[model samples]
Target: MTTHQLTEAQKKQWEEDGYLVIPSFFDKQETKEMLDEAKRLCDEFDVDGHPMTTFKTAADGEHVGDEYFLESGDKIRYFLEPTSLSPATPDTPSRLLVPPSQSINKIGHALAILNPVFRKHTLESDKIRSVAKSLGAQESPRVLQSMIICKQPRIGGVVPCHNDSTFLYTDPPSAIGAWVALEECTPENGCLSFLPGSHKLSRTATRFVRAPGGGTTFIDVPGVEPNEEKWDDMDGWREAPCSPGTLVLIHGSVMHRSPPNPSDKTRIIYTFHMIEGGKGVKYDEKNWLQPTEAMPFPVLF
Candidate 1:
C-alpha cells in the first residue's frame, strides 16, 4: 500500500512520534535484490574523504601529511557543509564517471519497486494515496527512487544528528523520508535516532552541507542547540533499531542521524523520499542528480 492509504491511527502516530516503523515493507526477494543492487553500485562508486574547500578546520595539533587535523565536531560540520569539499582530489583518478550527487541507478530489479510500485500505481495504492492526502497534495506524490545506505562493519561511518529536508531544498516544507532496513540495524550497527517533535522546529533550522563520498548532510543551523532536556523527557525521542524489511517513515524536518556501526557486518538500508508538488517547488540541480541519467535500471511494480 502507498503512504496515502495510511489509516488515521497510522497518520496520528507519525504526526506525534515523528516516525513510525512499518514492519515487513519488503518481502525477502525484493530485499535481496535491493541489497545486491546497492552493493553493485557501491562497488563501482568510490568513497573518499571530503574535500577541503567546503569548511574551515579547527586548531587541532595532529597533522597527517598535508591534511589538517579537524576536531570531531568540525569533522561533522565540515562534511555536512561540503559546498566546496570533494571526495577526490588532483592526485586521485581522472575523468570522474559518478555524479557529484551520488544518486545511483538500479543494477538489477532492486529499485524496480520504487519507480513502478510507488510511481506508476501511486494513484491506486492506498499507502501513497493516504500520504498524499495528508500532505494535501493528492495529485502529486513526488516519490523519489529508493536509495541504499551501506555501512561496512567496524569501518561504519558516523552520521551526526541532522534533518532530511535541507538536502531536498523543497519550499513550504512537505517532504517525507521512508527508510527500509535490509539488515538487522541495532545501536551497535548505527541505527537511526531522532529528536521527538523536532519536525515542529522551523524549516530554517535545517542546514545542508556537502558530506563525505559526495553525499549531503541535513543538519541544524550552527549555534542553535537542540532541546536536550525535552528530548530526554519525551519518550518519543528514541532510537529506532529494526530487523530486515522494517520500514520507518519520518518527516523531512525531523532531527535525525545514525551513529557509527561498530558491528562486524555491513549495515544495509533503503531510503526513499516523497515530495508534495503544489507549492511552486523548483529542483536544485546541484543536489537532485539521479542515477538513472548515468545508468539505467528496470522498473517493476
Candidate 2:
C-alpha cells in the first residue's frame, strides 16, 4: 500500500478552509479501474423494475419514501434525474423510464462493500488512513456510505448548498466526505463549490429521515436552527475544479453545492463519507438511511 502523507501546509489548509483538494490522489491505472467498474455497474443494474428515486435538493424538494430509498441502501440501484419525470400526486404513480442517454443521476451506499476494486481503494488504501490521521481522528474512521455521482450532460439536477452531517448525523457530527473525480470536473460540467470556513460557523440544523409512519421528512436537530445567512452569502464561496484522480475532502459541517450540467460533457465521480468510530461518538438511529441486512457499511482502519 502506498501511503500518501499530507504536508503541514495541507493540514493547516484543511483546518482553515474546511476542505482540501489533493491533485491526482489516484494514479491513471487506479482511476481507470474505478471508471470501468462504475460503467459495468451502470450497464448491469436493471432500471426497469427499480424504484425511480431522483436526486433531490434541500429547498423545494420532494421527500422520498423509506421503502423506495432505504430498500436500496446497501444494494446497487439507479436513481433518475428529477427532470426526467413529470410531477404526480400521491394517489397516482409517476415513475417513468429513464432514457439510456440520461438515465442515471447516481448509485449509492454499497459500491465499496460489494465491488472488490472499490473496497480495496476505500478500505485497504493507506491514503484514506493518512487522511483520517491528519484530521486528528482518535479512532479509526468508519466508512458510512459510498456512491458514484453522474452529472449527465444538459439535464443533470442541481444539488443545493448543504452539509454532509445533515444526511449522515453523528452525535458530535464527525462525517467527512472523500470525493474522487473520475473525469475532469469543470465549472461548466457542475464542479463542486464550497463556502470557505463554513464548517466552523454552522451546526447541523435538520436531518433527512423517514417519519415513524411512512414517507421521508426533515426533522430538526435539538437546539439548532437552520442558518440561512451562511448559505446566503456567496462572497466567500470558491469553486474547486479538479482533474481526473483528484480527491476533494469535505468537512461534515461545511456548506457546499454543485450546479446543474448545462455543458455537453458529463462529470463522473466516486465518493464516500467516513465518521469517527470511537466509543463516545454515537451514530444517530433515527437517520433515514441505514445499513441493509445483507451488507452493512464496513469499518476502515
Candidate 3:
C-alpha cells in the first residue's frame, strides 16, 4: 500500500468485517485536544431558557424528534442524557436530575463545520484527507454531520442497533462513519459492539427520515430484513473496546450498537459521517437533517 492509502490488510478488514478499528489513529496530542475541547464545550454551555431535552434512541421505538432536534442539522446543539432526568411530579414536568454539564449526552450535527477546533482537526487535517481518499467509498465524498458523544458516567444511554446509512441517507445509499475515541472505551463504559459481517448479509438498513405529517421517524428501506437467527445469537457479535486515540471506520450498512454505561467513567467519542455528493447521486430534500445555505455539504478530496 502507498503511504497515502490504507494498508491491504485494512482494506481486507473493511471488506470482511465492514468496519476497521485502527489503534492510535488520532495520536495522543490530537486526542487530548479533542477531549479537552469537548469538556470545555460541555462546561461552558449555558442552559438558560433552553429546553433540557434528553436525547433518546428508538431502542424503544421512540426518540426526541422535536423542532430543536430537526433544526440542528447545521448547528451544534446539546442533548441531555436519558438517564439523567429527575422524575416528573403532577405540577412539574421532568427535568435534569444533576447539573446540566454532567447531564449532556452530545453536542452534534455540525461540529466539524461550525467548531473551529474540530474543523481544524477533522476536515483540514492531512491525515483525515489521506484516510478519506484511501477508503474511496463514494465517488465524491461529502462530510455531512459530526458530533462529540459524551457517554456520561452511569447515566450514559444506549444506542440501538442501526446503520450510518439509516441516519445519513443518499441514493445508492452512501454513508461511512469516521469515529474516534477521545477517552478509553471499555465493556463497563459502553464500548461499541458490532454484528460482524452483517453488512453483507443484511439487506437494506432502516432509514430515519422526515415524516410526511411532521417531525422524524424511521422507515424500512425496501429490502429483505436481517435474518432473525443471526440477530438473536450473541455469540457472533464483536465487542470493540479501545484506548483514547483509536479510530473506527464503519461501513454504511454495518449493524452496530452500544449498551448503556454502568461504570462511573465517561466514554467520549467524536464522529462524522460522509456520503456521496457526486453529480448523479441524490440527496433527498425531505431528509430530517437538511443542509442549510450557510452550512451546505462540502466535498472532500
The reply for model 2, stretches above 4 Å from the true place, is 86-98, 228-230, 292-294
User: On a 0 to 100 scale, what is the lDDT of residue 88 in model 3?
Assistant: 72
Stretches off by above 4 angstroms in model 1 are: 1-4, 42-139, 206-236, 282-301
Weakest 10 consecutive residues, lDDT, candidate 2?
Answer: 94-103
Query: What does candidate 2's lDDT look like per residue over 1-301, in tens digits?
Result: 6788888899899989999999989999999999888877777766557666776664664655647667766776677777777677989876554665366788876778777988888887888777667667438677867889889888887888888998888888889999999999999999999998988988898887777887777888888877777485568889999999999999999989999899989899999898877788978668877875566667787
Error of 3 at 66 (Å): 0.5
Clashes of each: 18, 0, 0
Give the clashing residue pairs of candidate 2, or none. Answer: none
Give the runs in model 3 whose Cα sits over 4 Å from its true position. Answer: 1-4, 222-234
Q: Would you give me the overall lDDT of model 2?
A: 0.82
**How many backbone clashes are present in model 3?**
0
lDDT of 1 by residue, 113-179 (tens): 4334323332234553554465442245455534456555654556665566665555555567777
lDDT against the true structure, per candidate, is 0.52, 0.82, 0.84
Per lDDT, the best of the predicted structures is 3
Model 2, position 64, has a per-residue lDDT of 56
30-57: candidate 3 lDDT, tens digit per residue: 8999999999999987878678777878
Among the numbered candidates, top TM-score falls to 3
